[model samples]
Target: MPGARRLLWLIPLALVVTGGLAAGATFLGADRIESDLTARTRDALVAAELPSATVAFDGRDASIGNVPADQRGRARSVVLGVAGVRTAEVTGQPAEQAPEAGGHVKRDLQVRLDQLLAAEPITFQPDTAELTVQGTRSVSRVADMLTAAPANVTFEVGGHVARVPGGDPEGARTLSEERARVVANKLVEAGIAEDRVRAVGYGDTRPRSESGTTDLDRRVEITVR
Candidate 1:
């Protein structure tokens, strides 16, 4: 009778061991299958046997376009032949406007202009807020960006000053503020709304760059709102 009772106990233990082994086998089989499929897909992509083409994806669908004038047919064949990829819908017109669509118009315009916020140090006429030629160009570009923005756009003019050899911090702050106001006035003259602009100055508070000491200390930036 004791042996029969021990046999009953062993039955449950055996069931538990068999269940664990089944679960482990299932997991390993799934992993191997997934790994094999991934390898095949990667190899197929590298082979370029499917239709190869430049296609544009618009969330739901991909549309292929003229394949560089010379490789259109081959591109279509290659891209389409890929194992899992859906056939691409081809189009005649441009898929989407590129950054270079307008002859790089925006970039050209920005290049001709100057960054209102710069690390380069700019000095005004001695003791006055008058901007030199380079400063004027920078200020003009800022004005243009502001005015060209939507009519309801607002901006803040931030001025920074370099640490002068003998100047006091307090005076520098005041001067920087004055310079900021001067820039604001120029923007107004260039057709920006005066009511939408405010000015603030940081005197020797923010350095231009981490490495340099004096190359880029004084500057200005226009924050768009």
Candidate 2:
């Protein structure tokens, strides 16, 4: 009779052990899977020069942010390639509009222009905000481009900087602000009203490079809103 009583006690003890193990397994498995998913995302984005992004999973639905329309297709493609990623909720991609859509002509141009600006940042003297000879030439061309743009459109200058080697923590902000200001001033010289052009510096607060490389992360984007 004592042996049977002991057996009953063992049954509940066994259940408790099994339950604890199942919970631990679940926690570890989820952590491992998400870590792998994030690494894969970083690799693909860095390779493509797309902005850095993050993922959050609640069950099989993964939320992804910081992608542009030009790169959203790629994001979806790569995420779907990962095992167990059921649905990817992607946000922050620029809204794509066709020129033939009429009212969207300005927005369409903005997307293309932002892409161009990201590819090339206006040149400056080493460690200084002063524009180089080449930079002046670039801005001159930009003036003409802005002059030709729809008069009703408002142009915004966006400046981005990275946490760089040999650069002060506040330096990133100062440099970015100056860069944006210089461009905005040039636009005003090109005949655009000061109010029509908004100059805003994002500093190192909004980094775009997944690889953390300063060169690509330091950029200025011109957008129409």
Task: Give the poorly placed runs of model 2, Cα more than 4 Å off.
Answer: 1-103, 165-168, 211-213
Quote the positional error of residue 84 for candidate 2 in Å: 79
Among all candidates shown, the one with the greatest lDDT? 2
**lDDT tens readout by residue for model 1, 151-225:** 445667777676767778888788778888988888766656567789988876777666323435556666655
Which regions of candidate 1 fall more than 4 Å away from where they truly are? 1-127, 210-215
Number of the top-ranking candidate, with TM-score as the measure: 2
* Cα RMSDs, all models: 16.8, 15.1
Computed on alpha carbons, the lDDT of every model, listed in order, comes to 0.60, 0.69
What TM-score, over all chains together, does every model reach? 0.44, 0.47
* Candidate 2 per-residue C-alpha lDDT over 84-105 given as tens digits, one digit per residue, 9 for 90 to 100: 7888878665534213324587
